[model samples]
Target: MDVVRRNNVTVTGNPDGPVVVLAHGFGCDQNMWRLTVPALAPDHRVVLFDYVGSGRAEPSAFSEERYASLDGYAQDVVEVCQALDLRDAVFVGHSVSAMIGVLAADAAPERIGALVMVAPSPRYIDDDAYRGGFTASDIDELLESLESNYLGWSAAMAPVIMGNADRPELGEELENSFCATDPEMARVFARTTFLSDSRDDLKKVRVPTLVLECNDDVIAPREVGAFVHDAIAGSTLVTLEATGHCPHLSAPAATNAAITEFLAALR
Candidate 1:
């Protein structure tokens, strides 16, 4: 299959500028990065794509077995980079896509040089000395609820994940995005996202990295942000004044500024 067609890849921005890939999180498509695209387009070649089973990606390309682990998503990133022949591209990944970027960079070091991890959490379930903000049973219950009724789970969880109750539209948009996804595919992605642990991957990131986190994200708390920063040597962590996991949607200006600043420093 043509990787671009399979992933619904969309490229924009300055043709002569450095390449920057914007990857969305679970239950989200490339549209989620609409607010941030213009900011980078002025000075960077921006690439956007929807993972299979999400957004307008070819549904037939989705395989539950392939997507049962985060490696599958990383493969999607690697293949997209190869299709574009991207060299040392800057990968900006949101939510679960952040870890996927880490994996992709490790898998194809020449394709990606730097990383911008937005609202990332290496592990969601808490362990002995770590606080991932959720217990094992919590994840189990959440997954069980989602498996039972994905739509209802989306409607109820989107608002919480968005974290801007004052602006209900953001939550509604996320809920709609979730609803638009194939439930069975979403379930697989959800299980894969919530159950996986990528803490060990942090130490392997040798490229320049910026870890962006929200001031109040229910999904990825401050502790997780600190852990990520401390784990990755020579990484910069910026706490946006935003209050949601999806800061690109909730606080685009701040998020874009931080990202653009990071890009500038690299040059």
Candidate 2:
């Protein structure tokens, strides 16, 4: 398969510089990294791609069964890196893509230099010993909400997920991003994101990792970030004041700075 066109891969910045791959979370494409990409592109090789069924990717590449699990998405990450011949690249993933990075790095450890997880959670559903910030019932309710008004769910839930009551535009932006995705694809991605468990994968990460935790993310709580930090050996945890699940959109400056600082240390 032509991985480039398969995922709508785009590359920018100095060809000789270290590579940085930005993976957008569910409900969004690579456009979500617009604010942060420019900052990294000047000094690093920036790679951006839309997962199959996302952005302008070839729709034929999206297989329902393949995408039913995140390992498929992880495979996409590795293939993108392989096609581009990327090595020792910094993989920055938002929300669920963060876990996707984990899986990708585990599969091809040498390709990834480090990982930066923004508002990530291995499991969205809470367990008796773990507080993932959402219960199984809550996940069902969330699916129910999305199904009840599949079209409107994105617009309505954006504000709640963003957590910036004072900033209406931020929520509006997220709502737009969410609603712009293909509905059926969005549904499957959401299910894979919330229902899957990747807790054990954390312990297997060999590359340096950073977990960025927002203060008031309704989806991934501070505790969940801490748990990821603890589970991944020697992982750095940075608490941000972004107050949203999508900090790359709501607080790009701080998010960018945190990522910059982490990448600099690897240099």
Top candidate when judged by TM-score against the true structure: 1
Quantify all predictions' global Cα lDDT against the true fold: 0.97, 0.91
The candidate that wins on lDDT is 1
Model 1, 150-227: lDDT tens digits are 999999999999989999999999999999999999999999999999999999999999999999999999999999
Total backbone collisions for each predicted model: 0, 0
Stretches of candidate 1 off by over 4 Å are: none
Candidate 2 TM-score, C-alpha based: 0.97
Estimated TM-score per prediction? 0.99, 0.97
